[model samples]
Target: MGELRLMKGNEALAEAAIRAGVDAYFGYPITPQSEVIEYLMAEKPEERTGMVVLQAESELAAINMVYGAAGAGKKVMTSSSSPGVSLKQEGLSYIAGAELPCVYANVVRGGPGLGTIQPSQADYFQSVKGGGHGDYKQIVLAPASVQEMADFVKLGFELAFQYRIAVLILSDGVIGQMMEKVELFEQMPRMSDDEIAEKYPWAVTGKKKGAERTIITSLDLDSRKMEEHNHHLQRKYAEIIDKEVRYELIQCDDAEYIIVAYGSSARIAQKTIQLAREKGIKVGLLRLITLFPFPNVQIQELCKRGIKGWLAVEMSAGQMVEDVMLAVNGNGKVAHYGRYGGIVHTPEEVLQALEEKIIGE
Candidate 1:
């Protein structure tokens, strides 16, 4: 077992990266997430393992650095809040196009223009859909607590390497700032050359003295070839939906009303479920852990089991509700209850919304 300690979310993320055997970290500091960089800088695991950590000039530069390190067949990562994350979109798109492996932790804050330094989940669409451009998707993990934040760093890298795609840890400001208990395993050993070669024969390390150089590019001059490439990606996504979809159900097997939520919103839903139960509402909570390859099939199965309705509680206006609607597939009612911008809904308030619409009405 790993040693347990009280830690903040940002610190836990940094520690987890080290424990995950990340070779380098390239990122610029931003509010609510700067602690991740600060922790890494102070801890300096690079010195022990010959890893590299560089503070880039900008978010754009940071993501490009990640792309370069990832191209070299090295595990790498970066972290930032929403605004800085937005700035990294161009590089992110390029990384996606190249199908490189890397991890990005988005400690999300309110946005649209450096709106506020508070927590928000408004980036749901940006993360699950192609946040940058083109037909691409990242393996997005939404962590609800400090422990999950740390654990996802390891989980993200595993998924990244397995799928040859980038994985994102979608966290929020509150989780980044709040303190909680965490236990991290010792850093895993570095990949041997034979293991690396077996895993990534397509990696662009360098050309041998007589061998041909392998070039990595997203461009396809021929329309037919590009169409084929897009089709391949769609097929990969379909595979991911079958293999990677993850969620947690609480008291849902016998409930009438279900709360569909993720990240911190799920925590609120947990408390709201308890309150509704005390009032004899027969409410349940469905917490999504994997947001991208959404748990649509599961939701549909639940609806078929006579789940009467669903309340999508998010920190955004109405993002995930669309997915819930599609999942219910016209069989059950699905409504939205949320607090947009920087404001968060309390558990009592969420319970009230359920009473007003789901329970009483």
Candidate 2:
């Protein structure tokens, strides 16, 4: 109802950032996600909303820039594919170490090392787990459609500011490239400096007259202080786990089996559920929307409902399934199935895998 338009997922992300009142965007262009920046450049958010969009020379530079802006209480963001995101990990870690608020996106592509430009969920471990070195967690949103790709930008910023931590929108090439209808939100005014000062009293605004200078850094040379900081981060992560578990259930009331997936794989699983239901298979679909906070509680609740088994269908060799297995914890069997290295699994193939791996076997 806001403004409906057909848009590629990446373009939708750009428009959403503009309307989200983001202060800055600093990122490098990479395949499958380059449209994010291309759309921003063409639309010129500067003239529209005073948003500063800069294409950094490298992913490393871009992420560090994000760190700087976010430390000063500005809403900043960046986007990249797998490899490009890898290059930004150190900066991301630093941002996390300092407990900064910023948004990032990884339009994931196949990769162990530049494997392919095609979409893959192989980055699951990196996004949900700590990709950077440390004991920190990021709030990760997995968007299943172009509309979500747009909507999550606003949500991501909200979460980032709410918790004063990094947030990630984990998309893959499938959604990044696919065209779909999206209803975009109305524009939001950029936050003023006075508002930032009122909101983020800890931010490095500058040395005030006869006031203590604010220092922001992740570094605490003292081992005791470092341990305390880590404990603080852990507590924050636990709070997020308690409050931010988000997922969608499809035909799960009397389900004997459930297929677990996120993003594009979840989209395909919707169809697979229909096919299985037609064959009298009481299968349901659990589409996970937040990967980091993880829907472990939901899965456990399903186990309580007598779900016999689960099939984790993703675009990876097997990652999220491990988490599912942990959540199930011998309550039921958990198996993984997917087409890897950029090949998408068809609804029929997923149905077959579900039948063979958990049902038929």
Number of the top-ranking candidate, with lDDT as the measure: 2
Which regions of candidate 1 fall more than 4 Å away from where they truly are?
192-198
lDDT of each: 0.89, 0.94
Best by TM-score: 2
Backbone clashes per model, in order?
0, 0
Evaluate residue 251 in candidate 1 and report its C-alpha lDDT on the 0 to 100 scale.
92
TM-score of 1: 0.97
Residue-wise lDDT of candidate 2 within 1-361, one digit each (tens)? 7999999999999999999999999989899999999999999899998999999999999999999999999999999999999999999899989999999999999988988999999999988888999888899999999999999999999999999989999999999999999999999999999999888987888778998888889999999999999999999999999998899999999999999999999999999999999999999999999998988888888999999999999999999999999999999989999999989999999998998999987
Residue 75 shift from truth in candidate 2, angstroms:
0.5
lDDT by residue for model 1 (48-133), tens: 66567789999999999999888878899999999999998998888888889999999988877888889989889889888898
Lowest summed lDDT across 10 adjacent residues in model 1 is found at: 190-199
TM-score of 2: 0.99
Structural similarity to truth (TM-score) of each candidate: 0.97, 0.99
Model 2, global lDDT? 0.94
